[model samples]
Target: MTRQKWTTEEQEVWLEERKPAFLIANQKRCAAKSFYPDLVKEFRDKWPVPPVTQAEIDDAGSVELATRVKRDKYDKRTSSWYPNNTRTLSAHGGANEILKIKSQPQPRKLQAWQAYHALTYESKWKPHVNKAWTTYKEEWLAEHPKEKPEKTRLEVMVEFMKGKFNEENDDMKKRCEEYRNPEMQAVLNPAKAKPQAAINEAFQSAINLLPRTLATIGESLVKQTGWNITILAGGPMPDTDGTILTYLSHSGKTKEGDSFDKFLGKKDYDDHVLCPFEKFLHASFSMDGEDDKEKEMDDEEWKKQNSESEENENQTENVDQTKNGNKKSVGGLSEYEKSKAKNIAQLKLVMENLNENYPFPEDLVPKPALKKPAAKKEKKEIQQPVERRASMRNKGGDKDRYVM
Candidate 1:
């Protein structure tokens, strides 16, 4: 009988459905034949061929003989003898090759929702899907190197959700604006709007000016007098326009303790202890006469005038003595002169104390040597009184004096 060719539909049905069923049934038969010798013989008998003749056996080469001698050789086994047998169907050539070609897996086609569900819920398909996606991304990037790759499945889903939320929010805002009732409109508008407060421009100007003015004055004082000034902390005060203030302080030590906390001020700190300390520093350290040049010039002019007056007075006294016999004592110095003299004396004392305590730089100060026994004895005598005076001074006074 002549074999009939399969139509397209029949070929598809056989490949998609009937082929797998046939494979399973043939496998079962093969397994059964392994246990039953008669079943095996029956399958071999169905595809019978003539036995090898004596001449053909003699002509067989060594390799062919060795291959034929193997017990599980395809031709020798009943399992692979029949066409529909699982082993025959799985073989590498002929009908087996056709089956393998037909059985090549079809590319799965899924709807968007189905694909999402499969990716999310189907663990078995995840590896295959990930591998396919990676391959597709690489190919797409190769084709269009400049464009960014597509968003991931999860990212796309998240963006979809965000878009839905924004749409809902916009609808809500529109509904709020379109509400007809007056109370509802007022409620919505009031709830959405920010509140504003009334501002006093004049008060704000003054508030802002206060700290700036104070800072300017403090800076000028520091530059003129070389006093170290520090603005420790500052901030604006609520409900007081734009008023900002800072805590003023210095880094010196005082009799009580640190001068920083003791001399703290909100404004006009230059008028306090800083001014006096600066004056004392300038006076004590004014060796080049740079700080008090004007004062010195005034003093010289006053001294010249006073000396001329004294000379005239002396001439008058001499004339009186020559004319009368007795003269009155010269009047005392003026209050300004007395005060100036006192200040000069105080400045000299301060300088002397500073020299004794801190002294000048080591390079400028002379150091005594005590290499010999005689010099050592003299050095001890000199330092003994100085150390004793220092100890007595430390014990007598408030030792926490300002450092600068």
Candidate 2:
């Protein structure tokens, strides 16, 4: 509409007559449907909820002061973790204020951790990791004459293993051939591999064997305290990404076990426990034959290891590129895409609000010529109704609950 300065009388009349108000029910209002109740219920159900008190919330924050205090405490302790050491007991001070999430390892016939770190560790491993490391290191170095690639993790690991086992290297050419074999598939793509043989002998010795290294797969979301709410997620690789589980596995033991689920203590907290996150050094990332530390680390002690690897390893075509990339690619946005998608969503919601009665102006609204918003995919069925399960409080007297 063309604008013209309104006279005082005209402005007064417009204010009195043109202002619009629709007598819509609260249920029909957009604000009513958008958030509040639904979001609140979901948040609360996510349970042992965020600290119930202000003091706990204040204690939970990771201010420079808290970080420094935590660092000093951890520094004084018997460990060499980095500057912001989250593992210190100081870090767990107001922890219950944070919502904790941990991967619950599923009982599996074979876990990669067992296969890779077995006491008979070198048996099935030598054919793959060493060869791939030697091969990739050579080709990568040769191709880039000027650029000295930071040694790949595998290369560093091979060096460590060679010295530890007092093992000698095979010919470089022979190593390359081993790397190329079909059976060495995990060398190229770690997600799939001949995980250590999980035979009965391995299971029998598991308390003594599986290297749930003290290292953590990811950093703790909240480091300055303990947690009240801990959500259990199903880990895809089952303890591969977790810390030393030997003793946790040890405590859960039966005269005959591994056949039973929840045998591992944290596997049910009734149980409890976690790290660098990505920056882990002391913890070995090798897929095979890591040197053993007799004091097998447990869930409670997980958050205490190296913060990161020695360095951010280079990505090469020959390794970890062939299989399973969808692992991290399913989320959207450059904010621009998100802004557009969000705008479209808002427009559709506006259209619903107008709903044939109170229509918005033609040019301002998405025009009839413009394409309609894409239909939303149906939400996946909740095969497991785990909602509200976390919210249930401990009511004291024993009661049987349906897992389903």
Candidate 3:
């Protein structure tokens, strides 16, 4: 099949997708020590390569300067010019400024030369250039026959169709087996080596290939399972969460988010002090003893294992963290404290690496204020001349006393 010419396409589209490939064949024909201005001008006029803009050059210069002047210890250290930068982003640059194009010098955009070339280089010139180039090549080959190699009929040079996988091609399996490498065999399972086209066809076999919306799925589910499921949603309970809750109430309807209520429903919880809030009606995936089990593990060299406090409050949540599948203690720090510390460390590293000169925020670590202990209440000496007992006052303004 003949390749479709880009020049034959619509004027607007071809103009937009303007890519010029010049043949520098004439350069070889020039005299040994002589400069060819006429020859250079001929090709230059036909396939004009425009010079880059001053703005582009300036950007490149700035990038080069920034590269040479990297974030060093002198830039970071507390000096008259450079302040002590602990953590800041502005020292490096904004997200846009840090981009590949902004940080590193980029090649000029197509529009840089398109305006000048599009007006000058017409679509008709493509044919003329192709013809002239072809003629010059033939003439050169004729003049120097030795430059062109003689053709040979090598019997092994048979063309084979290298296209999409055909089931009928029995030779493909043999060829695959012959060229099978250990690396490929280790990576791909032969049992599950069905073609992607087959899988695609199998997946799209359904009558209705259009996406099934939430409502459609819900309807289908209702039909499948004859359960009259009232999708109680909205209010404090997030509707989008898709939480499935099943309950039988002894009283009135349950409130939003929580079903537990004295009047509505009573929850049977093992009476304990400082117990983690366990929702009875919830995903039972974590109800197993695995999550509840906490071992005294000190994996990190710097961090100390939390010695079990006499107070049962330590047994509550936020005791251990499962970060990236590694169950490690948060050094007895709360989530907020852990996040703040992590942020500070990250920012500090960035500051040192990027040579940021922004001043660190003051008073991040709050001062621990001393709390005064409360004084005990002193017992008042209540003495009567004769026998007396503690007197009781009633709401009716009547006083009753027992004789001692």
Backbone clashes (count) for model 1: 0
Q: Which regions of candidate 3 deviate over 4 angstroms? A: 1-104, 109-122, 148-362, 365-404
Candidate 1 wrongly placed segments (more than 4 Å): 1-230, 249-258, 261-404
Candidate lDDT values, in order: 0.39, 0.32, 0.28
- The C-alpha TM-scores of every prediction are 0.14, 0.15, 0.15
lDDT of 2 by residue, 193-219 (tens): 545654433543432221221111111
lDDT: which candidate is best?
1
Candidate 2 lDDT for residue 201: 37
> How much does each candidate deviate from the true structure in C-alpha RMSD?
41.3, 30.3, 32.9
Give the range of the ten consecutive residues with the poorest summed lDDT in model 3.
Answer: 395-404
Candidate 2 Cα outliers beyond 4 Å, as residue runs: 1-90, 96-399
lDDT ranking, high to low:
1, 2, 3
In candidate 3, how many Å is residue 183 off?
49
